[model samples]
Target: MATNILVTGASGFVGKNLSTFLQNKECKTNALSLRNENWKADFLKSVDAIIHLAGKAHDISNVSDSDEYYKINRDLTIELFNGFLNSDIKKFFYFSSVKAVADSVEGILTEDEVANPVTHYGKSKIEAERYILSQNLPEGKKVYIIRPCMIHGPGNKGNLNLLYKIVEKGLPWPLASFHNQRSFLGIDNLNYLIYEMLIKNDLQSGVYNFADDKALSTNELISTVNKALGKKAKLWKVSKGLIEKTAGLGDKLKLPLNSERLKKLTESYVVSNQKIKSALGIEKLPLSAEEGLIKTIKSFKKEK
Candidate 1:
């Protein structure tokens, strides 16, 4: 018999990729959009597992209402978890973000650290996680709260796409001097982990931080993008002091290179996936950081 899996927020990027991945694995997959009032009826059907990807994404534009995050990310998760508990689903996967623990990780982010989220988006996610943890699990049922950092893939149009465009345009990367390492989660690796958890029943159910085995600096990212473009990388090692002052001025003058955007582009946010690796009894994930990144960059070029 095929494993029946129900996915929420099936229209989103992660949901779409996961659904396809599961289908390729020969699982019976069903998509349940929260927009439909009859979603609960669908969720209550015969499902072996549930992957909850429906949530309000962090708004970098700063235009979204604070309540919206709580409503969708927190409240919706509570409703769905309650449904999972009551249903016959044996495994439940909740897609959370690294931002739920900290906006700026000083060092490598691990699952043991205390969560001190600043933004409403992070607050809502942590709240949902707390609620899920507080619940009692029945025998033979498992729950996994996965915190992935900056997930990127072929069809993704996030900050990575911005960098790819700049590199494709032959624009010189000016923040090469910032020298910060950040972690990234490839969609393929994420799908592999989820599939492993679904098939392997002995793995313990708890919070797990998901990231690539290696961390790459933004300068390295620029070079990788250039490599994918078959062009020589033009990385300008401008003085960090001058860049900071310019970003400060941009903050006041409403320029494109503001402090917030600059930090996002160059700050260090290394996440440790050792816990998950240990759980899976693997030294490394199937995809390396550069390999995954190059694949994503190549996909961007094909869209041109």
Candidate 2:
């Protein structure tokens, strides 16, 4: 019999992709929205797995109410996990962000790192994780908390989209001089890992971080985008000192590049995926970091 899967945030980019992938694998899938009134009902009793992808992301604009993150990311998650515990579901998957572990990673982030979330969004996610860990599960029940860094693909929107616009316009990238290594997870690889987790019954239940095998610098990313667009890479070697000053002034002058934005652009955030790879018994992800990124860039170009 095909496995029955219940997915929250089914309308999201990840959810849409995952649901389609699951269906293609001959699994029965259902998408539940946050507004669904029957979320806690016995409707989930028959589900083989529940994948929770619904949550309020960190408001990059810094305009959303702080309470919103906790209510959805923490409160709703606890309620759903409780339902899972009560139901017959054998596996529960929660999509957490690396930001929940650390807003900044000094070195390669491991599963052993002490979580010190800096933002309310991160705090909320960690809160949900703690609740799940605190509960006792039946012998056969398993829970997987996945922390992915900067997930990007054709339909997703994030920092990658911003970079794509710059490269698409043939504009010179200014912060290429920062030379920082950052980890990214491709949608394709993430989809494959989740599918494996669902099918592989012997895997341990715990927190796992996911990322591409190799970390890429901003310079390399710009080059990749340029390559996808069939344009010469134009990276200006701007002074870090001047960039910092300009960003500082942007804090009060209502400029586009603020201190926070600059930090995100230049900061090094390399995450290690060794733990997840080891668990999945895989040596490499399905797609190279470069190949997945180029695929996303080409989609953006096609959208133009």
Candidate 3:
């Protein structure tokens, strides 16, 4: 019999991709939106698994109400997990973020790091994780708390999109001198892993950090984007000091390249996917970092 899967936040990027993928594999999917007051009743239906993806994303503008993060990310998750404990569902997948551990990684982030989240969004995620961990799970029930760094795919919109616009407009990238490597997760790999977890019974239930097999520097990323567009990469080796000064001025003038945005662009945040790969008993993910990134960049070009 096909597994009946209940997915929350099915309209979002990750959820939409995952639901489509699962359905392709012949699994029955039911989308649960929090906007429906009787979502709990929908959750209690004959669902064999639950993939919780609903939560307020981190607002870089710092204008979102702090309470909303807790109410949805923390409280709503607690309620859903409690329902899972009492229900017949054998598997539960909760999508978390690496931000739950640290906002800025010193080196490579791993599952072993002690969580010390600084942002309200991070705090809310960790709270939800703690609640799920503290519960006395019944035998045959498995709960997976997955922490994925910057996921990108066909419909993604974020920093990757911003970078694509600059390159697509034939503008030269000025921060090529500020070299940095960051981890990214491809939606295809994530969906494949989740499908494996759904069918496999022996995998342990715990936290897993998910990312691509390799990390790529910003310069390399630009080159990949150019390759996808069939355009030569245009990068200017501007001085790092001048860039920092300009970012400082942007902070004061309310411009786009503020210090925070600059850090996000240039800072290295390498995440280790060894734990997840080891759990899946696989040596490598389905897509290499560059290949997955090229797919994403091509999607952006298509949208143009």
What clash count goes with each model?
A: 0, 0, 0
lDDT of 1: 0.91
Q: Tens-digit lDDT track for model 3 on 1-304? A: 2289999999999999999999999998989998788877776557889999999999978999999999999999999899889888888999999999999998899999999999999999999999999998999899999999999999795779888888889999999999899999999999988888888788899999989999999999999889988899999999999999999999999998999889989999999999988887889989998899889989887886
Task: Itemize residue pairs with steric clashes in candidate 3.
Answer: none
lDDT digits (tens) for residues 48-157 of candidate 1: 88899999999878899999999999998999999889988889999999999999999899999899999999999999999999999999889999999999999995
> Scored by CA lDDT, what does every candidate get?
0.91, 0.89, 0.91
- What's the CA error at residue 184 for candidate 1, in Å? 0.4
The regions of model 1 sitting more than 4 angstroms off are none
**Which candidate leads the pack in TM-score?**
1
Better by TM-score, candidate 3 or 1: 1
- Model 3 scores a C-alpha lDDT of 0.91
In model 3, which regions exceed 4 Å deviation? none
Give the best candidate by lDDT.
1
The TM-score obtained by model 1 is 0.97
Query: Model 3 reaches what TM-score against the true structure?
Result: 0.96
